[model samples]
Target: MSNELSVDNLVTGYGKQEIVHDISVSARPGQITCIFGPNGSGKSTVVKAIAGLLPAWSGRITLGNTELTGLPVHAMVRNGIVMMPQGGGVFPRFTVMENLRMGGYALDNKQVVEDRIEALIADYPNLQRRRNTAAGSLSGGEQMMVAIARALVTDPEFVMLDEPSAGLSPALVHETMERVVSLKERGVGVIMVEQNIREALPVADSVYIFAGGKRKFAGTQKDIRDDNHLMSIYMGGD
Candidate 1:
């Protein structure tokens, strides 16, 4: 009943190599928890491990009182945990409507799916305008919106996103960050791995900065801004 997603001492990696060391983090409802680092810092690795896309070599992942350690990806979704990977996680060939439908595949009721889709279209006017358009045809920002909206079709309690602002314009990056903040307002636990430090810092409630596959700092926005050492790490200084 805690309504928080917690990862404890997580260690995961590709075959015969550990990319993520023993790292612990938590995502609380109604707040944004950001994980940020330079390339190869294992930020995405941790996200994948929590999403059940990668197996943890050790440690535990929990949501409320439920243990999510070994659950498959589908079971994680059923348990109200959704992961929207990087690069706009939609089927490129499918229409926006079809992609939305696929997002609610876990639901058994057709009316529920329709209702959710309708609600999403109302929330995102762009989606309504492009409902029949192929997902691949949309711009980067629009596709990002579809990926996020699709994740919400299941109404997940905990949502994870990887580098949503990777290749977006300044305006679109601002817009995307705003949408992420809105997710927290809706009482969803948001765990975001972002490279856009400027955009991510303002909206984040807490932050974890990783370097060399290990957590270098974990604190609030103010803490990050005030610490010169942390800033140095971000600037690629040894």
Candidate 2:
């Protein structure tokens, strides 16, 4: 079985209207694959489709040979494909530990859940300090950290993050991107949809650029950096 997560000829949309037009992308273990486009370019739609929140009109999503196209969200979690949706979607009323526990909801073994949560907290000292605090009470960056920690509880092989750097100060954006890089360092394949081209490019191992619901570019960071026209269009225009 291949370790890479591959999306081939993906075509998906809302209600009969196609937003993403035959887009294909892939991510390998321990690498960061970033999808970037302007607003209304169908970046998030691709993520939602891969995460099983939306149905694929056509195409295939696979982890190695395992087809992930129609799997339910919980089933995807079980397959080590966890998605942290846009804006760090955390249950505001829930305590930090409670939120982490929710990430392990798909796991059948209670001991495994507890062990993973404990290990995550150990790795994130901030989570240890705020374990009992309500998620909403935490700062924005802190909440992002909580969201990441919760996702990690599943011990996912590949994580899909939508707009991870959204709604943050420049400094916090850098910190958040660092956390994302750390995920790659831990051998987790990361598929990130981001708007901050400046920040996203630095960490991106590979990039896919979309416009009008269609992919316009796909290559390494250097490929993007070398293309003066693309840099002007996405970086200057975005």
Candidate 3:
């Protein structure tokens, strides 16, 4: 199976207003693909469209041979596609362990769910240590960890994250980005929508830059870094 998530000629928006236009991007297993742009550039809209939270007006979204164009959120999860939204994804009132359990709610086998939770806890010692704490009580980085760990309980093939570094401390941002890199190491395709370009570029294998609801540049980290003009545009410089 070719573990590649491809988005072809996608167009979507809210109400009668269109935001994304003919956007095509792809993420391969064991690599990170980042989508970044100025505010109102439709980066998050594209993510939502691919995640099935927002319907696409026109496009084809495929993971390997599976078509994911119109699948609902639950159906997308069952197909090994999980999206963790910005801020935090945990149930604030729930305990850390409970939140993790909720992530595997689609699974029928209780034992399998428990086993996955155990594996996640073992891999993330902080989760094991704070298993009893409410998700709302943890630090921003810890909460993000729980969110990502929760997504892993289902063993998703493609994981999409939005603005993970927002409001995190410098150290926490580094830790969070490291965890994102670990996802690639585990052979899962990662699609990230980030405004933290400095932190995100190092981990990205490919990048797509959007402006005014259109893609302005699509290339590697080196391509973006070496181009002074692109950097000027990206940094809002004259």
Per-residue lDDT for 73-168 in model 2, tens only? 999898888999888899999999999999999999989999989988898888899999999999988899989988888889988999988888
| Deviating ranges (above 4 Å) for candidate 1 | 225-227, 233-238
Q: In candidate 3, which residue pairs get closer than 3 Å at backbone N, Cα or C atoms, i.e. clash?
A: none
TM-score of 1: 0.93
Candidate 3 per-residue lDDT, tens place, 1-238, comes to 2478899999999999999989899888888999988999899999999889999899999988989999998888888888988965789999999999988987788799899999988988988999999999998888988998998888999899999888889898899899999998888889999998889989999988888788787889878656576666564443
Model 2 ranges off by over 4 Å: 225-227, 231-238
Question: Between the candidate structures 1 and 2, which one is better when assessed by TM-score?
Answer: 2
Candidate 1, residue 196: lDDT: 88
Arrange candidates by TM-score, highest first: which order?
2, 3, 1
Cα lDDT listed for each candidate: 0.88, 0.89, 0.88
TM-score of each: 0.93, 0.95, 0.94
lDDT of 1 by residue, 154-180 (tens): 889988999988878999899899889
Cα deviation at 143, candidate 3, in Å, is 1.3
Q: What is the lDDT of residue 131 in candidate 3?
A: 100
